[model samples]
Target: MKSLLSSRPVLWFLFLFNLAVAVVAPFVVDGAQGVMTAVGMGVVSLGAGISLARDRGRRVSA
Candidate 1:
């Protein structure tokens, strides 16, 4: 798990992929629910970004 997270490309890929999905979600959803879908995605992406950052910091400190 630590090895995987230490890979810059993998971490970046996960971050971008989640954000991209969030952006595209609005188009895939129906009606006025698009806004809600987008917001939810944004939250998920943000959390992932934070987690990735913390993982990197731990690696650096160690």
Candidate 2:
């Protein structure tokens, strides 16, 4: 579980997915939908970053 969360590929995927959503949101959706999508993407990215950091810390401790 810790190893999986700390994986660089997983972090990169989260980043890229967020980037893709940000790029497409403007073209496909407007106003509230765009804002909601943006917020959701941000939350996911932040969660990924936090998880990665936490896993790395756990690995270092162990």
Candidate 3:
């Protein structure tokens, strides 16, 4: 798990894939479930992508 998370390509893939899920989940899922699906995936995508970017910047500069 640690090795996987540290891989930039893998993170990029997960970030994009989850972002698509966040966007499409609302239409595909139903009712409140759709909201949950969207929110959950959205959070994960944003968190992973943005945090990775921030960390990268910090690491590169440091």
Candidate 4:
């Protein structure tokens, strides 16, 4: 899991994919469920981006 998270390409892909889903979900779905789905996706995207940034920082410092 840590190895996967540390991969820059994979992290970027996951972040972009989740961001795309979050952006498109509103037009495809309806009501509170749609909003919740978008929010969840956004959160995941943010987490992935943060993880990538942290990993990069650690690599630089080490």
Candidate 5:
């Protein structure tokens, strides 16, 4: 469980899940709810991207 949490697979899953939500949300929902979904997805994606970048930078620096 610890290894799984620390690895790239979890990050990939989060990224894909957020992307899928971003893509499908507008189709399934309407109006304000859909917009909020999109905004939340964007925030999640941005956080994942920043985490990936920081991890890569750490590896490179070390």
Candidate 6:
């Protein structure tokens, strides 16, 4: 589970999927809840992507 979540492809997919959802959520769902959920997902995936990039940078520099 941890490895899967940390994978670049997974993070990329999540980020893109969440971004699409955030864009479409308002029309498909009621209130701010759907948009909020997508935003939360985007944040999580964005954080994961940043962490992955940072780790890769350290590896190359070291």
Candidate 6: where are CA atoms >4 Å away? 52-62
Pairs clashing within candidate 4: none
User: TM-score, each model?
Assistant: 0.63, 0.62, 0.82, 0.81, 0.77, 0.60
Error of 3 at 57 (Å): 0.5
Error of 6 at 57 (Å): 3.8
Candidate lDDT (C-alpha), each: 0.79, 0.79, 0.88, 0.92, 0.81, 0.75
Candidate number of the best TM-score:
3
Give the alpha carbon lDDT tens digit for every residue of 5-44 in model 6.
8677887787677667667776787777877876776677
Candidate ordering by TM-score (highest first): 3, 4, 5, 1, 2, 6
Leading candidate by lDDT: 4
lDDT of 4 by residue, 1-62 (tens): 97876688988998999999999998899998889999999999999999988988999999
| lDDT of each residue in 1-62, candidate 2, tens digit only | 86775588978788678867866776688899898887888778778778768868988999
Give residue 25's error in model 3 in angstroms. 0.8
CA RMSD for every model?
3.3, 3.4, 1.5, 1.6, 2.1, 2.4
Candidate 1 per-residue lDDT, tens place, 1-62, comes to 97886477776776788789779888998766887877877887787688788878998999
> Which has the better lDDT: candidate 1, or candidate 3?
3
- How many backbone clashes are present in model 5? 0
After best superposition, candidate 3 residue 6: deviation in angstroms?
A: 2.4
